[model samples]
Target: MMKIDLQKEFNDYTQNLNKASKDQHINTAITRAVKAYRSTVAESLERFPHTPEMAAEVREIKTQAMANNSELLAQAMASVERNKGKAFYARDRQQALEIAAGIIGTGKTVVKGKSMLGEELHLREYLEEKGNEVWETDLGEFILQLKKDRPMHILSPAIHVPREQVAEIFSKFFNKDVPPEIAEEVGVVREFLREKYFSAHVGISGANVVAADTGAMVIIENEGNVRLASGAPPVHIVMVGIEKIVPTFQEAMKTAEVTWRYAQYGVPGYVNIVSGPSKTGDIEKVTTYGAHGPKEFYVIFVDNGRSEMAKDEKFSQALHCLRCGGCMYECPVFQVTAGHFGHTYLSGIGAVWTAFVSGGLEKAAPLVYTCLRCGRCMERCPMQINVPAMIGELRNRIVNGAAQGEEPLPQVAHS
Candidate 1:
């Protein structure tokens, strides 16, 4: 009962995942994160009864976009170029990393918003390796940044950490008499991130939705840190998946509402949207690019097997996630095993994304059975996406077997 260290939980979850059988600690991390998400998203789900209808719309958006993927990509590319911004289409991770490195230059301190895409690219680690100072601005991500661990919950990075351990970590880092309270821990981080907001030379973020119509980048966050990250820095960089493209800002707004409701569970603690790096064109009746805004803006469109995910019947639904992370919370299996449920991406959704992006069935086999198969997450989804259904799809692939003796799943707790 020392209260779990979320950072430590992530560390332990990954470190011991392959070595030992499932333990209570792994269960603790997974369960706790899942619970937090489910409890909150449930209330929000009730707010909108149009969820089923909305889901159909979302599917339509996806279908229209995917059917003409090359055309959609062209539109998005053109829009970004028209906005006086630079866009790069990364065929894979290595290409994306190279694009980021060449643009970031050297000796610049970077402040990053919470972006799972950045995580996929290991952007912070890479920037650090290049001797650039990088700071995470999301409260959960910031804590994990201090602990140097991967994210547990997608939305809440430090969801694995209990309040008491958070107190300990914050206390040690601040060197102040940090209160042994969860509310206080959050407050402390808000205050701490203030300096990082203004001092950063560059900002890195992930886009929730990218509007192909206006070449606008839409970000949704409960905290205002993403706003500060993109606004404060002279240069703003967004690492976005190709699937994030939507037709218009109006469509983007509708999706944003759904995405926000999904994350907030009721009403978000806060929500912010950014349109091309905070520009001010009002002075002297002339527009300026760097006037209290970023002089340079780069959006990296990462393919990273997303193109592969588009064609699959069952698995393609993973692209429609909207980054809600609601499924992980509702998943009983994810609740206990924490990230044991995923690979880089954790939980049921992560399993699909991991199989598509990170590793295939061979790497994802152990995680396939972790689901309790409960439908709570799907019920709460604004798009009403069937996460459990997709997990089943992955399971079929595993049971059917692939690659011939690529290591079968260990006997986990649940089938």
Candidate 2:
């Protein structure tokens, strides 16, 4: 693991923010992407006129679902077992990694779908250290993997990488001459990952939403890679945050719809739902597992400070995030600094999340203060989380310290 110096991180973030503000290449790219995202979301909202009502219903469903989080989790585990799938609950990051490693044992080749939970756990690095070859199959994630860079945007992981840089990276990766055209670059990636998809012995992913009643895991993606990654392998493993659970399949589908809508898609290209291992009853009136898709299915629900966050009513709303990433595009500070003004997560919402999940005020100190309290993020948020208000609360906590006897560990933010 890389050693973290909190003071250094804060200073470097400030320097990067200053540098990003002056870099035309980066500023232009971010502006173009943010503008295009707004236009797409606007058009999609028009097409899906009932989105507001659906959003309201999903909000209530998520709130109620989270209120009974423990019960819902037990039901989900039972439902998964009833469906003949293995389920585990991980209390923290290390345990989550151990559960994933145990499923995809050593000396195996693994193909992974895009998972922010995977990032949170640093699963790829851990697996590689344990003697496994892990390949990220999502187009954006694959590019970031090759570049050895973190995601600049939640929806568009490699949003910071322009086409020219992608072409150069691909050329170096393949050791061949590659054109800078977007289509050509995409073809290069497709041809290379197609073999890995079939050859990998295990596949891993994160669920967008899980149904407690049916143990169904719903994943929405624009690319077809997630289907290939999760289906082709004999053993499929999923790592999801506990907050992703919804009460029923209907509510889960509604949640998925709201997610894609705000993610700038009228309807996602693929909405893959896997209840358990693939089964068929074609011969002798008997059902058989491993008919075509994955034969073994496992899910690990990670807590990792989420339960603690849920205990605080003011901060618990962070768990309601759909990861649609609309708020980042609407954030004025994020529009300028991109991901530099962020910690583990990004933008105004990220500040609150980092404060609770990643660490306390120390980790969030630098980014939280960057929020202008403009309320634009709340306007764009599908869940309508009050980011500005959350930032203010965190700021108060830092200044005043936690209650009567808690440690005062808030790292001071440098201007």
Candidate 3:
């Protein structure tokens, strides 16, 4: 085994954090976003007083789901296959990318919805390297794609980018004058991605939750891009983390509802539940697939160190994250430095995720120490994840070298 030097990693991360703390764009954008998020979430909770109670129930569901993850994963895959869809399990990032590339051959166009799992695997860049033209259909993701920038927030990927910067990005990409108006900015992207949605050979997305009993991919979105992207193409591919699966459809719905409520959406514009490929039995009692949607469907359940995290009692709770991103707004370090405070995942929870999923303890060492441990993030987290406690445990591991035997996953660089 080789010794690792974390001093330079720490120094580089510190420089980036300090630079981001002083960036006017990040400060202004996050300030506005935090204000709006707080107001919206408060009103949403007030409107649906039962949301917190439901969230508590969802927590139990997540706990049980994680405990029985392997069984549920097997059942979910079987259900997908039974429903006329292909199912795959990727033990690591490389295999996950290869499976997707095989499905979508070279020189094909792909339109994709926003997916953090996709980010964890660096899917878009990988597909592009394989000779495919991939277009991000989500508005914020589209902006980041054109600018060649990484996500600044989980739910709102380009939260650090204000409308003015978005206009500049759009103008440069489209070679036309785009105003800083929010509605106009959205209209241009809509017009541009509309063509890609219908013309693309494959469509890809990540699910908010998966129902093991029925093999349903439940996706919650507001932009309507997912509907077009997944429905308009000849092939639809779903790349989701194994942690997203639940035991039953009803439990899945409860989880999805709690997810949206905390995400500042009272009721998301769309909640798509796709079980299998499109089919119809109207022609003389004969069944046929591809009746207005993708003829082929595939689901890749990725386990890039997730199973290891699930088996560890001390850190299993981190897998319960809904990715609603409510906690980031309440995090002091995150509010100031935005995504620069952490890596692929952001903030305190991101630190834990980076250790188990994205990067190893070496990459997570700096982020683990950066946490202020004020407990504000826990108060806002719907799952009530003990981020401060996790940070403390990670620090102990670093000092005692308890993580020495663990193998680090391949690093995926984010801009």
Who wins the lDDT comparison? 3
Tens-digit lDDT track of model 2 for 277-322: 9989999969999989999999999998899888887678889999
- The TM-scores of all predictions, comma-separated, are 0.84, 0.95, 0.96
Total clashes for model 1: 9
Which is the better candidate, 1 or 3, if ranked by TM-score? 3
**lDDT digits (tens) for residues 245-364 of candidate 1:** 888877777777777776754555545555564566697867677888788888889999988888765556678778877666666666555555677887667777888887666555
Query: Residue 108 of candidate 1: its Cα lDDT?
Result: 78
Cα lDDT over the full model 1: 0.74
Worst 10 residues of 2 by lDDT: 406-415
Error of 2 at 153 (Å): 0.5
lDDT of 1 at 28: 64
lDDT values, one for every candidate? 0.74, 0.88, 0.93
Error of 2 at 125 (Å): 0.9
Model 3 deviation from the true structure expressed as Cα RMSD, one decimal place: 4.4
Ranking by TM-score: 3, 2, 1
Clashing pairs in 1: 6-160, 6-161, 27-336, 30-334, 30-335, 30-338, 31-335, 31-336, 34-329
